[model samples]
Target: MGRTMGLDYGDKTIGVAISDELGWTAQGVEVIRRRKPEDDMERLRQLSAEYGVTNIVVGLPKNMNNTVGPRGELCIAFSESLRESLRLPVSMWDERLSTVSAQRTLLEADVSRKKRKQVVDKMAAAIILQNYLDSNSKR
Candidate 1:
């Protein structure tokens, strides 16, 4: 079976992660620095092809009260664009505190501030993907 891709889409960067072929776990790939819209899509397409990704999971940063705010709207738009461009099934996973969790994990590990900044996005993507995988597995 083909793997699934996870994305943590942000204004400045996009964190990327990929599931194993069996779709049990997620591993961070890289952070794509945001540039042009087309550029972002192109990079996604390339990574999708490279990783044999058949599905996509984009993190939707909802508010604590479970409301979709402006950031969530952006994620929805991005997911739509991914669906249109890649012709793949795109799912949005609620990621209310995925980034915060990532930050805390890094801090607990004693990761340097600079290093955390460089890797936090991808780490957050992995957390998002892992959470999605876990929830889906029980269904």
Candidate 2:
């Protein structure tokens, strides 16, 4: 089966992750610097093809109160765009504090600040994807 792709979309970047063939785990791929909507979609399309992605899971940044804010709305819009452009089923998973968790994991790994900055988004994407996979497996 093709892998599930995970995305962490932000104002400046879009982090990418992909599940293993078995869909048991996730790995950080790349952090695409955002330019234009079409450009981002094109890059995502390339990644999807390269990784043989069957589906997409986008990280939705919700507030602590479990309500979607402006960022979450943006993610929802992005996901809609992805569905139309990629013609793949797109799902949005709650991603509150995913970045924070990534930062913590990086800190524990003793990664330098500059290096962490470069990879944090991708790392967060992996975490978001892993969480989704784990939850689904338990179902």
Candidate 3:
């Protein structure tokens, strides 16, 4: 089976992660610094081809009360663009606490502040992807 890609799309950067070939686990790939939408789409297309990605999962940041705010709407729009560009199924996963969880994991691992900042987005992507995998497996 082909692997799935996970994305944590932020204002300044997009975190990328890919599932294992067996679709078991998620691993951080890299953080793409946002430039232009076309540039980002090209980069994503390249990564998808390189990693044999069959689908994409984008993290959707919602408010604590489970409401979709502006950021969430942006993510939805982004996902739609991805779907149109890649012709692949793009799904949004609720990522309310993924960033916080990633921060805690980094802290527990003794990662330095500066280092954590560099990798937090990608880590959050992994968390989002892993959560999706786990939930889907239970069904």
Cα lDDT of all candidates, in order? 0.96, 0.97, 0.97
Instruction: For residues 13-68, write the lDDT of model 2, one tens digit per residue.
Output: 99999999999999999999999999999999999999999999999999999999
Candidate 1 whole-model C-alpha lDDT, 0 to 1: 0.96
Error of 2 at 56 (Å): 0.3
Backbone clash pairs in model 2 (N, Cα, C under 3 Å; residues 3+ apart or in different chains), count? 0
Tell me the TM-score of each prediction against the true structure: 0.98, 0.98, 0.98
Mind giving the per-residue lDDT tens digits that candidate 1 earns over 1-139? 8998999999999999999998999999999999999999999999999999999999999999999999999999999999999999999999988999999999999999999999999999999999999898999
Candidate 1 backbone collisions, by pair: none
39-100, model 3: which lDDT tens digit per residue?
A: 99999999999999999999999999999999999999999999999999999999999999
Q: Residue pairs in steric clash, candidate 2?
A: none
lDDT value, residue 33 of candidate 2: 100
**lDDT for position 82 in model 2:** 99
Candidate 1 similarity to native, TM-score: 0.98
